[model samples]
Each structure stands twice: as C-alpha cells, then as structure tokens.
Target chain A: MRLRFRPVDTSFYDLFTESAGHLVRGVALLAEMLSDTADHDNVAARMREAEHAADETTHSIVKKVNSTFVTPFDREDIYALGSGLDDIMDSMDEVVDQILVYEVKVLPPELSEQVDVLQRCAELTAAAMPKLQSMKELEEYWIEINRLENQGDKNHRRILAKLFSGEFKAMEVLKLKDIVESLEDAIDGFEKVANIVEQLAVKES
Target chain B: MRLRFRPVDTSFYDLFTESAGHLVRGVALLAEMLSDTADHDNVAARMREAEHAADETTHSIVKKVNSTFVTPFDREDIYALGSGLDDIMDSMDEVVDQILVYEVKVLPPELSEQVDVLQRCAELTAAAMPKLQSMKELEEYWIEINRLENQGDKNHRRILAKLFSGEFKAMEVLKLKDIVESLEDAIDGFEKVANIVEQLAVKES
Candidate 1:
C-alpha cells in the first residue's frame, strides 16, 4: 500500500450522491414513460426537466472540482464519472423524447424490461455513490452493474429480432427502434459510470 | 505559451497516423460497400480485416503508452485519440456488416453522400495526425471536421426522414436505418477525435 496525504472533502460525495439521486428520479420518469397509460406529453416534459436538473448536478461537480484545492479522487476521474452519470440522463431523456416526437403509440413490453434493468442499475449506482469514500465493497457494485448491462444487451438483441420478425409495421419499427436504442444507450451509460467508479477504486487502492 | 520539457517520442505520432490511415482505408471500404455492383461479402470481409488491423494499432498505442516514460502528450489523450480512431473503424465495420447481414439492397443515394463526408473527415484526420507535433495550423483540421460533422448530421436527418417517408418497406427501412445510423456514428466518431485533438492542443498551449 502506498501512503499519501488524503484530504477529505465530503461535498464531492454529497454532490455525487445528489447526482445519483437525480438518476433515480430520471429512471422513474423513464419507467413512467413506458407505461401504457403514459401521458406522453406530460412525461416527456418532466423528463426534460429531470435531464436539465441532472445537468446541473454534473455542472456542480465540475465547478467543485475546479474550485476545490484537492478532489476526493483525480480531477479527470471526477469529470469522467460526473459526465458518465449525466450521459445516462441524456439517453433516458432521449428515449422519452423519441416516444413523444415519434408518436409511438405502443411500446414493446421488452422495453419495460430494459427499463427495469436501468432501474436496477440506477438503484445499484445510487447505493454505490456514497461508497466512493471508502472505496471498499465497490467491486460488487460494478460487477452487478456489468451483469445487468449484459442482461440489457441480451434484451436489446431480442427486441431487435422481434422488431424484424414481421410483427410491427416498418414505420413503427423505425420509431420504436430509436426508443429501444436510446434505452440500450442509457444502460450502456450506467455500465460506463460503473467502470469509472471501478477504475477510481483501483487507483485509490 | 508555457515552457515545459517536451520529450518527443515519434512512435506515438506514427502509430496515430497509422491508425488514422486505417480509417482512410476503412472509409474507402465503406464506400465500396455502398456500390450497386459491389460484392457485399468481399467488402465486408475487407472491412473486418481493416478493423482488425486498426485494433492492432490501438493495442500498440496502449502498449507504447504503458512502456514509454515520456509520451508526446498526456497518456489519457493518447488513449482517447487512438481509441477514437478505432471507434470510427468499428462503426464503419458495423455498417458494412449490417448491410451484409440484413441483405439490404438498393441503398439510398443519401448514404453515399454520408460516406463522402466520412471520406473527407478521414482524409483530414490522416492529414492532421502528423501535425500533432507542431500543433500548428491544426485549427483548420478540427474546424473542417466539425463542419463535415454538421454536414453528416444534416445528411443523417434527411436520410431518416426519407426512410420514414413511406417509400421503402418497413423491413427494408429497418435494415437501412441501422446502416445509416452506423455511418452517422462513424462521422460522429471523427468529430470526437477532432475534439480530443483540439483539447490536446489547448492543454499543450
């Protein structure tokens, strides 16, 4: 083990935790958007607000990193992790927006399954943010997130195969495909954040 | 400008140039894939080879970064640039593979236009890699890439609108959309590389 001066800044953790909190809300909105009775316009409007709020959290992380004399981890790692979280929100928001603008009347049930994966990833990620301070017991967080991402990947291919299975109209397939991909992108974004956290743990350890 | 001890390791630049060189070939293969009389299998096979070769170059850059004590630029930036180039190849390869797998026939002419933008971006990137050492007159390279990216985006939206225009069959639309998005992704990959180069120059200056 290497000994170094560790200056503790609790706000970074607090801000990251706050950031993850927004994702929790964001995922809920995403789940709501997938509901059959979803008010597409209302859900999408709220999603936009949630995404903007997530962006603010990201910007706060950046500002804190710039102003603070010492960061909890590396400056670059902080930026990567912060932006990684923000990217997830952007993807989720894209899904909602696609559902709205494309006027996709019926979303496949499998999409909800993918959102379920995102919800789990979000919960895991939210639970893991504060754990950044200890850098202990972090491995399981990334490992589980990776597992969920793999499941999401499987779900994605299954969805695509179905989309091409001659069930839905080509036009509907076109619109739904965008939503599906955005869902996949959001899941991938979570995996990226996990990777960043994992890397941070490795560097810290 | 800040004066810092700059150690020149020509290999990193060479490897980057070599990586960008693969993109040039990759884009050419992409163009060939779009031809009316082109052998889709052969073009796809060649693209796979090009992608594999690009992967080797990326690995070489990583290995060199790990072994070399003094790099030309930041190690992260080097990794980012090398992988950025590699990602473009991956997206191109994906486009080719999708065409082959989906058996998409009669591709839209708009796709060829997008590939034209990619070819231009690849050529400019290949031209710009050597300029990393001087970091001079490189602004035009990124500016051109950004301009081409905007052009590609416009082409992408036009292609999407056309795909959704009720002309092609839904199944065909599904197939072509994958190829179209992959092409757009490749162009976006180029823009990302340019952005990385721009940031590198800013850091160096």
Candidate 2:
C-alpha cells in the first residue's frame, strides 16, 4: 500500500487554536463568577453562557473534523484536544450549578486560590495551543505549560489539606471540597491539553 | 521512505487481559468490603492491598510499553488502556480511604448498589479485554460491556437524585454524597476501559 503524503492545512490548526482560546475564556468567566459578590442566579447565568459558548466552539471543531479528510495532527489528537477543552467548561459549569443550587454563601479561601490557579492554567494552555502550529517556535511554551500545571497541582494539595483540617462546619466543608475538586479537575483537563501539545511537539521535532 | 511494519506480539494483549482481571478482582473485593460489617481498618487494608497489586500490574504494562518495539495498538491506545485500568483501582482506593478516614459508619443503600454495579462493570470490562486479542470471537461481549456501562450510568443518576433528597443530616449527607460520587467515578473508569476495548474491536473489524 502506498502512503499518500499531504501537508495538513493551516486552517485546521487555526480552529484548534481558536477552540483553546474559547476554553481559556470560559475558565476566566468561571473565575470571575466565583469571585463575584452578586446574586447566585446572576453568577450561574454568566457561567452557563460561558459553557454554551465553549460548546459552540467545540461543535465548530467537530464539524471541521467531520468534513476534513486530513488534519494538522492525528485524528485522535484532535478529538482529545476538543474533548479535553470541553471538559474544562463542563467542570466549571458543574461547580457553578452546585453553588447556585446549594445556595452556598461562603467561599473558602483555599478554594478561591485554586480557582485562581485554574484560570492561570487555562490561560497558559491557550497560549500554548497557538504555538503548536509552529512546534519549533513553541517548545518553550510547552515547558511553561508544564510549570503552570505543577503550580496548579501544588494549590490542589494545599486546598485538600485545608479541607481535611476539620475547621469549617460540615456543610461548608462539603461545599468547599466539591468546589476545590472541580477546580482541580479543570486544571487536569488543561494539563491533558498540554500533554497532547507536548506530544505534538515531539512528533514534529 | 518505506514504512516499516513490525508484527505485534500476542503476549502484550495477554498481559492487558491479566491486568484487567486483577482490576475486576479488586472491584469485587471492594464490593464485598463495603457490604461487610467487619472492622473498618481491616476492610481498608484489604482495599489498599488490591490497589497496590493493580499499581504493580500497571508498572509491568508500562515496562512492556517502553521496551517493546512493536505494539498491537497505537501507543496512545496502550497508554489510555493502562491509565484507564489504573484509574479504577485508584478511584476505589480513594473511596475506601475516605470511608476509613472520615469514620463513616453507615453505608447508603443506593451507594452499595452502585458498588455492585461497579463490580459488574469491571467484570464485563475484564471479560471484554481478552476478546480484543481476537475481536471476532467476542463481539457480543463488547456490546454487553457497553450496555452494562449505560446501566451503570442510569443507576448513578438515580442514586445521586436520592442522595440529595434532604432526608439525611448534614454530615451524613455529605459523607454519603462523596461515597456515591466516588463509586460513580469508578464506574466511569470501567466504562472507559470498555470504550477502549470497543475501539480495538472497531480497528480489528
């Protein structure tokens, strides 16, 4: 069997970068909602809007994948990137939903810090995605993404430790713990995106 | 450039099947432990042993992946399978750890049922793995695995709804909620293994 070689189109790369940017924007919106002192319904509505936008962006990428015969990266890589990005939005949406439904009034300082780390991690992930189209120029960004992920992990540990300290009331503890876990999950999704980008860098190199 | 086609050894498939079998056994042990009225420490110790065994099995698979020149599936597929199987053990271990550390005395009825479902999911997943080595022989089992996953998902939703019904005390509710979520997570891991097996079936077909 003869292997047909064709350079992957630049547009697919652009779509992927766009998707990553949307994910970053979604995380930023989530952070803003978390930090907000407004009514619960208002914050939840904003987070839901962010999730809807991320969903639309993911749909766009999927449509491109369905129509294109060739992709800039492996088909599985593209799917993973799309799914991983969407997971970040889903995680945020879940946290927001829980907060609103439970009417959780107080936010733990530790959980607040985790959300901040998650926002920064998403930003780094978004920054790294564009560089993937030109792997040679983006090698340093991959390293930076890894560093940000490590920082997120550290924050996760700190938050978990505080949750187990028996300081907060049981209900407060449960609410804060779930929020922290979801934030960590969002960061994990970002880390997966970075891992895929690093794999792309290796393949390109 | 000529693409080199290296034949995959059957032994790796065998190893994965064996590792999956170990995971099923672990889930079974967990279900039994959760149902038992025995000493909490003993139950936790048993769960820890199963997790350690699964970890060792995962390490073996990783070693095989690193040293083997040819693989039966894509490298990413192998990694996904390895990690997916390991996640089951990790999730179960975490649940048991939480139960023990939190001094949780009473288990929720619905959560126990989910544990049963998780055990069955793991068993079906293990059953499906050996079939991937020769996909034609076990197509029916692969379908069954998917059906079982869907069933597990339904059970998860039902249990989660029951958990938040405002029946239990605040601390009790929190503990039950965490356990239910953890069990669902374990089932999700099992479903992921089934998914990978289904993917392999597709490739083989």
Candidate 3:
C-alpha cells in the first residue's frame, strides 16, 4: 500500500466550500431584495450580516494560509480565490445597498433575469469548491461560468438599452444603472473565481 | 572582489516606462476630447491609435516576462503592474468613446478637474517607473496617488450630486453619468498600479 506523506491540508477545501456557501446565502438575499414587497432596510441589514460572514470566511482562509507551513496550493492562488469569492459577495451586497440607498422604488423587470444568472453561478461555484481536492471536473465549472458571464453580459446590455430606451425616468435610470452594474460585477466576480481555480488546477496538473 | 552573477534583465524597466509614456499621451488626448470646439471624430481616432499603442506595450511586457527567466521582481507583480497600467488607458479610452458615441455635448466642467487629477497621476507614474530599479522614493508616488484618489472620489460624489440636482435633463444625466464614472475609474486604476509597485518594493526589500 502506498502512503501519502505530505498530506495536503484538506481544511483549505472545506474553508473554500464554506466561503462559497456564504455566496449562496448572499445571492438568496439579493434575490429577495428585488421583490416589490421586500423591506429594504431589513434586507439590507441581513445582507450586511451575510457580507460580514463572508468576510469572516475570507479572513479565516487568509489566516490559515499565513499560519500553515504547507498549503494545499500556491499561497497567492489561495489568496486570489479567497478574495475573489469575497469580491462577489461585496458586489452582491453593493447591489442590495444601492437598491436601498438610491431610494429606487420601481426596478425594471429585466433585473430578475440577471439575478437568476447570479443564483446559478453561486450554486455552480459552491459545487466546484469541494472538487478542488481532486482537480477534477473544474473545466466544466469555468466553461459554464464563462457561458453564464456571456449571458450576463447580454442581459447587461439589454438592461442598459432598456434603461436608455426612454422607458424609465432619468432619475430612475441613474439609480437602477448602478444596481444593474453591480449585479454584472457580481457575475463577473464568479467568473474570476472560476478562472483562478482553472489556473491553479492547470498548474497542479 | 565578489562578482554579481545573476544579472536582472533591465529592459522590463524600459518597457514599463514606455507603457507609462503611452498613458501620458492617452491622457493628453482625453483632455483634448473635452474641448468644446474639438472634433470628436479626430480625437477619438487618435485615442484609438494611442490605446492600440498601449496594448502593444502591454503585450511586449507580457512577452518579455514569458521569454526571459531572470526578471528583476516577481513575474506576477510584473504582470499586475503591466496590466494595471494598461487598465488605466482602457478607462481613459472608454471615457472618450462614451463622449463620442453618446454624442454628449456640454461636458460638466468638473470633469476637467478629474482629468487634471489623471494627468498628475500619469506624470507621477511616469516618474515612478524608472525608480522601480532602485526601489527608492516610490513611497511619495503611491502616497500622492492615494491622496489624488481621495480627491477623485470627492469629485465623483460632487459630480453625481450635480447630475441628480435636476439641473440637466434626464437623458443628459444618464449620458453624463457614464462618462463621469469612467473618469473616476481611470483615477482608481492609477492608484491600483501604485499599490502593485508598493507591494513589489516591500517584497524586494
């Protein structure tokens, strides 16, 4: 029987999985924030909590990487992945915050489609985090993310065009544009995390 | 006498300097684009050429990093700094393009102040690139950038407030906000480059 001597710190995988878990929760809050009946203050407060939780996960990952002598992957890659996930959360939180602070009462219906894209991305990212151990099946994760990002881009343009299509009042357009861009940034953040995972996997392989 | 054997490739310095030089020219074009009597088409054409030139410099730096082994600093830092500089040019280009494509007339005068900030950052960056070799006097470069970024942030808020102040028509506010945000992004990009330089300096020291 062959024995593995330098056992990779498997906790890193768990931490990453935990990090993605925060994103899943954060995205759910984002979706809730879009509803017409939603309480803006209540949702924003919960989102702040979710964001803080995501930050805790990120800091845990960073602290672990700094203290551990032998990490599962390159320290930089670990840091990038950790913070990349955090950035997505930040973007999501920003979307919710904008919706609240901007006092934007009427959101375009098209924004719901963007939120759907983000939900799918969060789920896919959560699924992919655990598989970092085997470095197996991450290709599809990134490929799908790239695909979703393209979809998000199309949605983004459509949303922008709609905003500029003389549909909404100018003040509303100004407020919603910031929110829409934040949603796009969140999706792009997912793709960035997937790319980091792809790079790490390639180097490991 | 002990002889130094592992000579660092110094061309990276020149390439970075060349990259910053492109930014100086790009910002000049951006300033010209703001002139009311200026021909948008002519200025946009020149800006495109300048952007392409910046891309070439970025590619050269990436190619050189890939081909040459003995880099002066970490390869990743080189990549970050190179792309960081490239990103600023992109933001500047986007501002000019938005002005042209949106056919935006009567740019807010506050925008010129933002451009002044960018011009200073470009010059500071151009001055700081060569100093990477000795890792000396770069603190002021980044410190000034942070200060400038704060100034830019203040300007951004003021601009947004003015846009929402009911002074301009809704359509005009929509168009001008995009341009204003792009200008703010360019300034932020400069700060990002400075941060990379600061990190590289710390690591090398």
Candidate maximizing lDDT: 3
DockQ of candidate 3 compared with the true complex: 0.17
DockQ score for candidate 1: 0.19
| TM-score for the A-chain in each candidate structure | 0.94, 0.86, 0.94
lDDT of 2 by residue, A67-167 (tens): 88877887777888888888888987888888888788877666667677776776776776666666756656666766676677667655655565566
lDDT of 1 by residue, B1-205 (tens): 9776998655888999999999999989988988999999898888889988998898888778766777788766777788789889878987887777666778888888998999999999999999998999999999999999999999899999999999987687777887898899999999999999999999989
Which rank order by lDDT, best down to worst?
3, 1, 2
Candidate 3 residue B19 C-alpha distance from true site, Å: 2.2
Q: Which stretches of model 1 miss by more than 4 angstroms?
A: A1-11, A14-69, A73-80, A86-90, A93-161, A191-205, B1-10, B37-49, B59-68, B136-178, B198-205
TM-score of each: 0.68, 0.65, 0.68
List of clashing residue pairs for candidate 1: A170-B170
lDDT of 3 by residue, A75-160 (tens): 98999999999999999999999988888888888999999999999999999999999999888999899889878976876677
Candidate 3: segments with Cα more than 4 A from true spot = A1-11, A14-69, A74-80, A93-166, A191-205, B1-10, B38-56, B59-68, B136-166, B198-205
The parts of candidate 2 lying over 4 Å away from their true place are A1-70, A79-83, A86-105, A116-120, A123-182, A198-205, B1-10, B28-70, B74-80, B109-117, B120-128, B143-167
Worst 10 residues of 2 chain B by lDDT: B136-145
Say which prediction, candidate 1 or candidate 2, comes out ahead on TM-score. Answer: 1
Enumerate residue pairs that collide in model 3. Answer: none
**Candidate 2 pairs with clashing backbones:** none
For residues B132-175, write the lDDT of model 2, one tens digit per residue: 66676665665676677678788878876776788776666666
Rank by DockQ (best first): 1, 3, 2
Q: Candidate 3's residue-wise lDDT over B31-138, tens digit each?
A: 999988989999999998999899889888877876775778877678779889998998899898788776777998999999999999999999999999899999
